[model samples]
Target: MLILWTQGDTNGIGSEVILKSFHRWRHRPHRAVVVGSYCMMKFYEKRLNLTTPLVEIESLNDIPMQEKTPDEPLYVLSLSCNIKANVGEIQADAGELSMKAVERAATLCLSGEADAMVTAPIHKEAIAKAGYPFQGHTDFLEHLSQSGRAQMLLCDIETNLKVALATVHIPLGKVSETLRASGLRPHLTALANALTKNFGIQTPRLAVLGLNPHASDNGVIGKEETEFLQPELALLKQDFCVDGLFAADGFFGAKRYKEFDAVLALYHDQGLIPFKMLAFETGVNMTTGLPIVRTSPDHGTAFDIAGKGIANEASFLSATHLAIQVAERRRHLETTA
Candidate 1:
């Protein structure tokens, strides 16, 4: 598969991690091309003192129509940014460049020019400063792909733990109202389909966490669980092998996530806190329910460690592997169908 990897914030660790990950993937079978500023990548290449040769390409067509060999240099479809790298500061130009790369990569995937996409981390604040109104990559991708609703799925291959968020990039106070407004059915359906189609699970068992404390402490803490979750879960169970209303604290505290194929959390931190605790170094964030496959490292652009040359690329590598695996599975399903 030909993967289009985006260069995220130029001032952050995106370039560092991408270069590091490429250095480690020299023997991998899949072909990948970077879509960002050639100068930025070159800067990181020199800073890191790595000899992974970079071959600049004017467009995706410039890539040779063959699997990249171990001896081959990394191909880069360089975009023009014309900004110097500022190691640890957020710059509007950096944000613009990052989003531009994402736009190009997503367009390629939608056009079938690229099999899948592995995005490096983009700084949210910088993007906002750049005048784009996207909450994050998920919503931006949803708009770009025109996918009805995109879901965030976090996975740890080592522990086989997967968590999908019902509401993302929203305030804690608004999660309840948002859930009430949109309901949980769509998210559940998306999660189920993603597990079956992308992860190759046959008859996946799904679990959902409660909205309130102790699932509303049996209606003592809050009414969201009693009034909203229970009824929705009952209907969802008819269509899915799903169980829910589990207390987030004890459910994960007692390691209940392992019993199911995937767990669905009501909000972001509820799912991410535990998942990050378990697999921070190797977590992969996947954007599901999109027309094209997309995944990124679970962590963000670590500004403090941007130019230190100590940034770990484990999560990015895992994201790359998962993107390739999901893309291949999708290809198989398409051919067989």
Candidate 2:
């Protein structure tokens, strides 16, 4: 079974994308179980007018090992929070439900009941206001798994480009310090391994981006690029197809980015700005180095237009598809080896 945990409140587009992805992909052999409030889901079903039925399951054992008939392709393990969410409005109750959904998803993934997990966008401010110490979904999941570091990779299969960030969710002032040798190599290694093992990229070509303007103009603008990044790149190239310290400005040019399989960004915006520009609606945010596979949409919770019923689900749908593909690939490698 593939358990998909959605951050709560059906009033938002999360509910819309959850049902949309399930409806579109339910023909697969695996069953998708939603971990969220039953009432919230039902509200979404009525609002979106989707015909799919959501079943409430007590446990993973309640699901049949195999479907006797081919008609039922999906199931929902509805864990009800029973909270009323005001459409397009942020509230404490909604925040609580979102956190619960995240917690449930992490626990299920850890327990081996779910093959892979896909998370919907959650309101970070709402979550923090509710007293959760999480920086975001990736940080929360990494903390839950007790993993060393979680590498964030944005992939667009159409272009065969996978961009991973060395520093995420941090202020710009700290980006240079964060790009030091102790910080960069581990994530580079993690992304390289994930590409080979899960995505079947045998020799992944990696391009590392420069931190400052024009890669610090060869150390005239900043010395961190030459001091920290160049050394790390040299060490990484020993084991992988790692190349860069390329100037961030020119790296995203049409010719340069297409030359490599993946581009390593120094900071969040340094990479995401170009990434979004290229594949805003088609990208997938995949977390590497996790014990269990996890992916989310490249976008975040659009609180400004939360419940207007106009949020696009393209990124979320792409993320779901990527998670399933990676999970199936991992399963295949395990079975064959």
Candidate 3:
């Protein structure tokens, strides 16, 4: 049984993708129980004309992992807040529900009932406007998991390229301050461990990116690379296959990126702008260093296209598949070890 705790509502692409993906997976040997609002899901269900029944389950034990029929396990866990989810408009009530769904999903995972979690794209601004102090799903989940070392890893299956961010969701001005000598080692260590454990890469070849243009041109532009990044890279090389302090300008050239399994970016835009450009529709955003696996679409809520039935679900679907892959691999290692 695989408990898929979907957070985003039907107004966005989350429920649509979950339903579509469920239709694709229903015939297979798995159980997908949705953790969301019943009314909101019904709204999308009618829109998509979905055939799968939305059974409401109170406990994880209610999931019937072995069955095939209309009677088979299909369900929803409804929440209190309700609003007419305008297809393209962001609403505080919708954002509140989204956050609650995530909170509940984390509870399920921590309680050992769910094997893994696949979250839908969330609108951070909407969430904040709702009075919730949230940066993004990764930060929210890290605190929910009570982990100090959580990291974000991006992978596109088609490209077989994985990139992890050392610092995320911060302004360009603050990235260098965040990438201190004390904190640098833990992010890199987490990246290496997650690459090996989740993606099955042993001795993962990691390329670390520089913070400034031309990698500071040997300290002509900035000193972060030589002062902080290089020493950390040197320390990590003793036990790991790691290299870099490569200039951000030329690091993405064909010859450089192809040689490494993953690139470690100094900050958000330094990494994501290029990543999204290259792997926009196929990327999977994974949260590493958590006890349980969690992944989400590399994209965010398509507010303009929300409720239009036109938002692309490819990224969200990719994230779902990646979550399953990593969880199954981890489960296998646990079984064999």
Say which candidate scores most in lDDT: 1
Candidate 3 positional error at 281, Å: 1.8
Best by TM-score: 1
Q: Which ten residues in a row have the lowest lDDT in candidate 1?
A: 60-69
For model 2, residues 1-337, the per-residue Cα lDDT tens digits are 4657565544457887777777666676666677777777777777767766777676777777765334663455666656786776767667767877777888888887788888887777677877888878889889989988788999986666688988889889877666663556787788888888778889988888888888887789889877777776787788888887888777777458888878888889988988888888888889988888898888776666765557777887787778889988888998999
Q: In model 3, where do residues sit more than 4 Å from their true spots? A: 48-52, 68-73, 181-183
* lDDT score for residue 224 of model 2: 88
Q: Give me the runs in candidate 1 sitting further than 4 Å from their true place.
A: none
Candidate 1 lDDT tens digits, 265-326: 99999999999999999999999989999999999989989988999999999999999999
Q: Write the per-residue lDDT of candidate 3 for residues 24-77, one digit (tens) a residue.
A: 666766566777787777777787676667777666676565565544646776
User: How accurate locally is residue 158 in candidate 3, as Cα lDDT from 0 to 100?
Assistant: 77
Better of 1 and 2 by lDDT: 1
Q: What is residue 128's positional error in candidate 2, in angstroms?
A: 0.7
TM-scores for every predicted model: 0.98, 0.92, 0.92
CA lDDT of each prediction against the hidden true structure = 0.91, 0.77, 0.78
- lDDT rank order: 1, 3, 2
